[model samples]
Target chain A: MTATDTHRTIEAIFRIERARLIARLVRMVRDVGLAEELAQDAFLTALSEWPRTGVPANPGAWLTATAKRRAIDLLRRDRMLARKHAEIGRDLSEEDDAGIAAIEAAMDDDVGDELLGLIFTACHPILSPDARVALTLRLIGGLTTDEIARAYLTSEATIAQRIVRAKKTLGKAGLSFEVPRGRERQERLSSVLEAVYLIFNEGYAATSGANLTRPALCAEAQRLGRILAGLAPDEPEVFGLLSLMEIQASRLAARIGPDGMPIPLTEQNRARWDRLLIRRGLSALERAEALGGADGPYALQAALAACHARANRVEATDWRRIAGLYDALRRVMPSPVVDLNRAVAHCMAFGPDAGLALLEELERNDDLRNYALLPAARGDFLLRAGCSAEAKLQFERAAALSRNEQERAFLLGRAKACSV
Target chain B: MRVMVFVKATEDSEAGVMPTTELFEAMGRFNEELIKAGVLLSGDGLKPSSQGKRVAFDGPSRTVIDGPFAETRELVAGYWVWEVKDIAEAVEWVKRCPNPMFGPSEIEIRPFYEMADFGDVVTPEIAEQFDRLREKTPAR
Candidate 1:
């Protein structure tokens, strides 16, 4: 075939097979850094030979075979590294073709466990959050450092350094390449989920930027969530997190305005919401519920979002149920943010006066004094309660406190509308 | 199962340039092959991103933003929803298709989550409800 065609094929093959190849290699070598190098070496070999030799029937197997051979050769050549050689030098006596076939055969076995191990290793809590993100995307997401950097809107050098540091930390810590057992496994899983959700939240609402959202980050996080959900199907929280993200993401299309400002839920056009994502989210929520995680923190959040997703219009929303959910969430995972949301839900379910009372209480609290949303919510309630002058002042406060330019502009616009 | 194959937009597509006749004919033949193989469920191309708009959100408020979105890499020029046995089978078919763009392009294949993929979480009642929903709207 043509040169470009061959290149595209090889690239696609590498994207599809890299995770499995590296996972298996990591299993053998017990070093993520070495495993990655071996996997890349295999891809380099394919780039050089596949164009001329034609694509193999099973390219993944071919790549794995090549990587396994290279790994063995590297280990054998390192005469001083007796421990490294001893650790990986297993059944290496077979000659060329037989050896390749044996390694390929081994790759077909226990890929699931190997991949799970790789994921846990990448997301080990010992590494810093930044390092975990970089490593997870590189190893499990099958993304290059450049791709990870581009996705996060950071410099390639920064991401590269983060990854190198992560691998070095993993090596120094001597983390095992196996999914931990029992409670430890759950803890590791939480770390993995946290990293994914943190990435999604940053994309969903950037902490500080001209734009309200970064769609690529949301997409990447969701992609990683899906992969995790598939890997740990029995984990109720995996489904919970996936459901939550899916439903929240459905609103992405309706969350921004023509002026590049943030849009509140009440004003968003329901028709613009992505129905497919809502459906997916609902199905995932159902799965979470069936798996006995309906009250789980993420699942509860999913239910809250579902309350909105199910409504055809803002007026049709089940405000009372949403309020009730907030109450439940408060009991289970009582955070200031949850309490703030609960206050709004109470107002929506009761009246503007009721919400105003809660906001007034929250206002006296020092913890939420700097939170822009607290003021924003208070302003909305006051405006609805016919205290427009007071609402105007609150909106101005929110605008000043907000870091995101789009959000500040939105709040300032609210302030202007209430000025009269 | 069904997979959505997204044809990523090239610079030409983002600029609203139409595919050349040769490329169009080549894609047509490719689609015909898929059709003959009973793999092609549906296919369509999208207009340029310039015609699109984004609605930004902050709680209950929304703001609309007109597009010629800065990120061309995120744009899709076309998509095909194909029924395939699995992702590997889908990849095999994609590998045989002619280039969909004059310049370098990408096709991302994502599987639609089948009810079976959800395992026992999809109870019989839920499965029945899903079946009814599918009957109401067959596209899924």
Candidate 2:
């Protein structure tokens, strides 16, 4: 093979193997940062040797063996600096096969467990939300700092600092590189899921950007969700989160118009929806349901997305079933956002009056004053209820509040279309 | 299962620039690989959207819009219909493809709707009609 071809192959293989390699090394070295450094060293070694020697038969094992040796060498240097083991002869013969075997054994031990541990460590609550996202993408998603920065539309230096600081914070906290058990496990898992969901949401609707959505970020989050589901197969919530992301991501293509304007769900061409992702999502939903997670927060949300996916057209959507899901979801994970959605679902199932009452109730809360969607939902219901002039005003309000350029344009277009 | 792989229009493609000889040779090798693996059903590259036309419908009236389409991102330069096992396998194969344009390009993989996806909505008569159409089409 050509040199460029070998380099590309090595790069692809390293992207796939880096996370597991670092996870295993972290288990031995007890340092996330150091483990990543060792993993990179192994990659550099591959870059230099693989072109001349040809790729290793088992490149992952070769990389792991290299990283393990680096760890032992570091340990040997530490022991010599301490000089406390002089009587015990801290100097080990470099040809010691048993010592190498011990390191290799630890590197291969419980990979799944080590991966889960790495995930939990990266998403540890000690770090801020941005730090958690950067660190999680760096370690779990196997994304480079440059890629992470591009995904977030930020400077690479900023992302690099976030990852470095996050690793230091994790080390300073003396966090164990082991998955917590029982309630602790559940809580940590929730934190991990929340970070993943947050990334997906940001991607689904960029908080403030010229574009309506960032498809790359949405794809990244879905990839992360799928990876999490593979690692924690038995965990119903993992499947729940995966199901929700897949179903929602399926709609991403149809959600934006050819002119880059936001296309509301009812108006989107259902034919453009990704059927494969929907199929994957429905199977994931089935798995979550089979595991008795029908009422779990993510499961319930997935059920809502499923309702849309199962429908052949907007008019055929099972709004009543969706409203029922929202009611159940409200009980489990009560939020103004869920309530607003429930209200909108009520409008579809019942009438605009039912939804308007709920919206009025929501308006009394000070928290949702700047939320553009609240007014947008109200405008939708008002338009459906034959209050076109009132709907126009609400659309204008929504357009004024929206930070997204495409969404603002779409809302303003709605306002312009309202009857005089 | 079938996936319609869209090779998105790049500046090189939209500007009517042909691919390099190396890229054409690489793509030929790739297509041969796909055919050998029994993955590729049909594939073709199209001229720029300027050579295309769009028919818009308003009620029963037809309005034909001439291209070049303003939105370059929405334009397709080529397409591949591949008979793959699933999305994952399709993605795996697409990842191995050489760049289709002279510069950077994107290929989007979208699955075709099987009659089964419609579930009970597609009646037996419709299924038979679709089956007949499938039989009439060229075999993969």
Candidate 3:
């Protein structure tokens, strides 16, 4: 391969192996911060040397070895302290090729699970929820702090500090580098799953950006969810999360038109939906129900998504079942967002008038005041009710409030169509 | 053992966006869990960096960095000092607390030194001063 290809290959390998590499290093050093720094140093070294020597056959192992050597060098440099130096020397001597091979093999064996553990660690409750999400994406998702900040429309400095402080807190607390257990595991797992779902939702329908959907983020979230499902095969929420992402992802191909504009669900070409994703989603949902975890917020959402997945057309969707699921979700996790969604379902199940009443009730709450979806949903209801003038006004308002380019364009199209 | 858990502050966190009702409810559930498990000593959110001041001592000269420090990442948002049996026990407790941020955030934990930990080199006077300082500061 050419030098450029070698560099690209290294980057790809790092993207896939970054979490595992850091996890293994953390295990050895017993310091998350130091482990990450070492991992970064290794990446820098690869950037400088990989091009000249060509990529190694086992790039992940090579990077680990390189990082370990650097760590040993640093330890040796601190040899002025006799006792500390000796400790370092002892560790280095003990970690011969055989030990290194064992560590590498162990890392490769449960990499997915280890990555999930790392995610839970990053999302630990000790950190602020924002820090948890930021750290998880940075460490487990292999995303840069800057990337995460941008994803959330925040400053890079804010994200950088959150990460630094998060690592420091973990270190200071001397938190163990392992997945939590029992009740603690269940709680932390919820946050981990929530973070993953948040990432997927942003990718599925970007809150704000030039593009409507960031397919890469969606794919990554789905990949992580699948890994989580495998690691915790009996956890219903895991399957629920996977089912939701899979079913939502199945519609990606049909959600955009030939010109790259947003396509309303009713307007989407059902033939273009990925049947494989739908199948995976249905299977995951079944697993979740079989595990008796059908009552969770995620599972309930997945069941609602299943209604759409089973439908051949938008009209064929079991809107009443979806409405019932939303009702359950509201009871479990009450929020204006859920009510808005329920309103949409009610419209389909009964009529636009019923949905409009629910929407109006939700509108009284200040939380949805700035939420663009309220007006967008209202506009849809109006359009169906043949109130073209009122619908046009709501659509225009929605178009004005929306930050997403695709969403704005979609709303504007709806407004223009009403005018016609 | 006295362990210090550092809660990294974010811009929103410092702004005193009084945890929303939902956030409080979530945190209350977590705190109840922590208290029930006997891991929580005391904790509270911090004021914005703009309201605080950092004094750096070098030799005899002290440099005071005003609140709203330019570096958000470097600021300490809040902290908790827990009396635990050991680091392992502290970790178990921290694992149960609710995340304080609405988005990605982190809390760091560090061990505090007791007079007994200082061996014979440290005098009682210094220990007294450390105790006084600990008293002046909030539990986090």
Worst 10 contiguous positions by lDDT, candidate 2 chain B: B131-140
Which runs in model 1 stand beyond 4 Å of their true positions? A79-108, A206-214, A389-420, B1-90, B93-140
Evaluated against the true structure, the overall lDDT of model 3 is 0.76
By lDDT, rank the candidates, best first: 2, 1, 3
Q: Give the chain A TM-score for each candidate.
A: 0.87, 0.89, 0.76
Candidates 2 and 3 compared: the better one by TM-score is: 2
User: TM-score of the candidate numbered 3?
Assistant: 0.59
**DockQ: the better of candidates 1 and 3:** 1
Error of 2 at A132 (Å): 1.3
The window of 10 residues in a row where model 3 chain B has the poorest summed lDDT is B131-140
DockQ list for all candidates: 0.03, 0.03, 0.01
Question: Could you give me the TM-score of model 1 versus the true structure?
Answer: 0.71
Docking class of 1: incorrect
What is candidate 3's lDDT per residue for A38-99, written digit by digit as tens? 99999999999878887676777788888888866665455436566355546545435555
Q: Write the per-residue lDDT of candidate 1 for residues B1-140, one digit (tens) a residue.
A: 56999999888898899878988888887775564333565678999889999999999999999988887877888999875545766887787678887777788999987534898898867766754564334112
